[model samples]
Target: MKKRWIVLDGSNIMHWKGNGADLATVREVTRRLGEMGYVPCVVFDANAGYKLNNRYQDDAELAKRLGLPSARVLVVAKGTIADEIILSAARDQNARIVTNDRFRDWADQHPEVEEEGHLVRGGYRSGRLWLNLPDEAP
Candidate 1:
């Protein structure tokens, strides 16, 4: 069977100005998912002059150094929206998406796309993040 794909909304998780806490959280989640053998794709939005002085360059570079597939970490150009791109990619690839946006409601409306909630518990002690998959009736 093909490995499950997890699409992450990089822009949503990073927040404006690239908050450190948010970035750390995202990195932790990504690392954990990799440990679990899940394919993760994180998409971030880039401005017109992003190539000149990009804030996420370090992130993209790190992902590259880690040998992450190019297709899995994308930086969408300006004028193109990240949310829409993420949704489209998920739908096209039949992959599960991870986002805190209500826009996920649209995916819930689709019969083919399964929507689930993620919970990350614990502060300093041993913690775990769980993916709450939709309950399936036998």
Candidate 2:
């Protein structure tokens, strides 16, 4: 079976704990997404490391933490946000984005996000992960 490509909003997902940035949460999400048969590519803002570890985290380091190759983990340039990169990656890959954001701000620019199942939203409930995605990956 061919695995579909999918994008993850690392900057947003790292904060899933509601306390501070958590790399474990990101890893868990990545693992679950992969188990669902999607190739998960994560994009993070420049300061993700600082928020999570109070230090800089390059793509290689983050990728190692997520058990993915550096190429699949992108840390955008300083002052650059990850939203556009994440959305663009999803568009280019023709894959859905796993994020809680509706991308309403970019609705005019990224109209594809409005399509059904374009964004796979999910979160941890009592330590269990649940994603609202189609049973079959496209």
For candidate 1, the clash count comes to 0
Residue-level lDDT of model 2, residues 6-124, one tens digit each, is 89998888877677889898999899888878899999999999998899999999999889999999999998868889889998889898888899998899999889899888876
TM-score, model 2 to reference: 0.93
TM-scores, one per candidate: 0.63, 0.93
Best by TM-score: 2
Residue-wise lDDT of candidate 1 within 1-138, one digit each (tens)? 788777776655554223332455456656666776778887766641143244446446645643577667877766777777877787777776665555745555454344343311212223444433342111
Off by over 4 Å in 2: 136-138
Q: Return model 2's CA RMSD, one decimal.
A: 2.3
lDDT of 1: 0.56
